[model samples]
Target: MVYTLEVPNTYGYVVLGAGVGSVICNIVLGGPVMKARKQLDVPLPNLYATPGVHKNADEFNRIQRSHQNYMEMLDSYIAMTLLGGLQHPIACAVGTVFYYIGAILYQKGYIDKSLDVDLARYKKGGALKWIGFFTSMYSTCALAYTMITAK
Candidate 1:
């Protein structure tokens, strides 16, 4: 007998939510970058403001790096959330929620003038990030393992 994989019908909603959330996250994080770009006169093709040459360079760099850093891992987050949701919707969804919460906090901590001095402020979000990432990763691995061993 072969074990067949079955995904819940409602999981589709979870996937769609994740997609919408991703777009929202992108916009939320990127908005400041665009504002900083115009304010700082960071022209196209030059991704970041020069540390010494540009006024308010430190702040601009923080904003840019926060957005850039999030984007760097977004694809993985989406993949894990969606794929893992196929078999473990609740876990994936919960993980995604935590991840986004962490992301927002992480961005806030990085850019907050009062908190910027302590780079460790970002660690608070980082912990939540790992919780989410690992949950999805575990789900994905579980799904893969189930599929592979199914006969």
Candidate 2:
């Protein structure tokens, strides 16, 4: 006997959420990375880091930091969606939306050069930055539990 997983129609909302999130991430990351590549004269592939001191190293760091901040949370969001999405699409959708919102918060702070102020200033908006993390984490945990104990 083969067991098949059921993907509910509601799951589409989660997909939508993921789509929105991806676009936000790509758009947010693109500007800095692209500008950094050009400003550093390092080509697109080498945008990850500034390599050595360039005239625009400080500016490049802003772009690089925003990209890094987005990626830092991306994996966890993807994992939670994949692991718990089928079991709880509504939760996943909500989680995904907030996760994207959280990323947006981080990106806004990064591009504004807010992080440069200091660690305390960087975390000034504590609730906003962490809501996504908490929402996804809780929903994913709940979904995982449901999956394991299903009758």
Candidate 3:
């Protein structure tokens, strides 16, 4: 009824990488949003541009929202990846990849000006987003269960 407390070195590294990668992705995504805000003349402290009031407001809003959406999920993703990596590194790693890929695709689709459907383009990456989120959730739960049951 004993358990080893050590996490595999590779697993630890993978977890660290996932966390760092998420931050880096967020930072990179933000650059475009910042540039769009400046170029489109979106002022600071305004969460969003007024529809039809600001020139190209929709475009700038979309760009900003894409980055904001990623930020919204970043904290949870990092936490799940770290906790889950303790028990299931491979699963967490895969989940991280899925999430990032999905996030990027979602961002691209959301920011595309050609799409006239407003937020509908997010559907393009919605499936992967769910899959990745669930995967991480499962792994994190497994880690919790293991810790509680361990002797």
Name the top TM-score candidate: 1
Worst 10 residues of 1 by lDDT: 116-125
Q: Write the per-residue lDDT of candidate 2 for residues 21-133, one digit (tens) a residue.
A: 66766686667677667766656555454546466666666667666777776777777775567777887777676666566655556556545634422453423546656
TM-score computed on alpha carbons, candidate 2:
0.72
Candidate 3 deviant stretches above 4 angstroms: 1-4, 116-119, 123-126
Q: State which candidate, 1 or 2, has the greater TM-score.
A: 1
- For candidate 3, the per-residue lDDT at 77 reads 76
Candidate 3 residue lDDT tens string, 19-126: 677877787788888888789888888878898778988888888888788888778878887878887787777777788778877878888887764665575674
Q: State the lDDT of candidate 1 residue by residue for 27-143, as single tens digits.
A: 888888898889988877778889777888888888888788778998887888788888999888888878877777777778887674467436546557778888889988988
Indicate the residue-level lDDT of 148 in model 3: 85
* Clash-forming residue pairs, model 2: none
Runs in model 2 deviating more than 4 A are 1-6, 39-42, 48-52, 114-117, 120-129
Q: In model 1, what lDDT does residue 61 have?
A: 85
What is the descending TM-score order?
A: 1, 3, 2
- Model 3 C-alpha RMSD vs. true structure (Å) is 2.5
